[model samples]
Target: DKYTGQPLHNAVVWLDLRTTELAKELAKEGGQDRFRHVTGLPISTYFSAVKLLWLMRNDPAVAGAIREGRAMFGTIDTWLLWKMSGGHSAGGVHATDVTNASRTMLMDLKSCEWHEQTCKELGIPPEILPEIRSCSEVFG
Candidate 1:
């Protein structure tokens, strides 16, 4: 969730390709194996982190919101859980299952926590990340 504890709007859709350039840059910096060992993910626009980075760089609204402590991000599941659990208006659960978080290229494949180095490298604040959870447990 955001530092303000609010849910931000217009989550970067996972399929958006706006992050292609940034993805290429990341790949060049570390090759495919850099984060692959920890996240099992190559630097690609397909991941949530890449998309988030793109939004932060290209969309002023998103960037401003984030800097203002008014942003958050997640996969479709995270958004769904937030809404279903009552959202910020209530106290929606800001969480995601490991399987989903793993797909985001943010979670550490080993410990299932937000990878600090990766987040710093990508300039994505760890606060915007959702809580990691097991797939079998109730999220909210």
Candidate 2:
């Protein structure tokens, strides 16, 4: 579940090589597909934000966590970085990589940041959103 009270289960974190190959296949099958160009990866519901929403709606603990700000919402990369950085609550480096952010449908494709409108549309709070960053940048 995400810190935003989003429920998540069976979340799949696609490995870099696997994601790349999937994107290539998708591009080959559907020539000039914008998904591959924009995201640099194949689109998959498994790696995205829908599950997070589900968790938020169903899990009471998750809902409380989000409200407290003690929980953080992030993709796999962001979670990893937070854990690696000592998980400090004050400035714990909560963030998400561009590619992972793109899959969420919550991030603006162009700005690479959480979209307020999207959050509202999805019944999510902008407050719990993760900071967006480039895939290569270090979070620590």
Which residue pairs in model 2 clash with each other? 5-56, 6-52, 6-56, 7-52, 7-55, 7-56
Worst 10 residues of 1 by lDDT: 1-10
**lDDT for predicted candidate 1 compared with the true structure:** 0.82
lDDT per model vs. reference: 0.82, 0.59
Write model 1 residue lDDT over 1-140, tens digit each, in one string: 44444544465666778788888888888795578888998888888888888888888877898788777778889889987898867878889999999988888988989999989988999997899999989887
TM-score of 1: 0.89
User: Of the candidates shown, which would achieve the greatest lDDT relative to the real structure?
Assistant: 1
Best by TM-score: 1
- Please list the Cα RMSD from the true structure of every candidate, rounded to 1 decimal place: 2.4, 7.7
List candidate 2 segments past 4 Å from native: 1-47
Clashes of 1: 0
Candidate 1 lDDT score at position 105: 85
lDDT of the structure predicted as candidate 2: 0.59
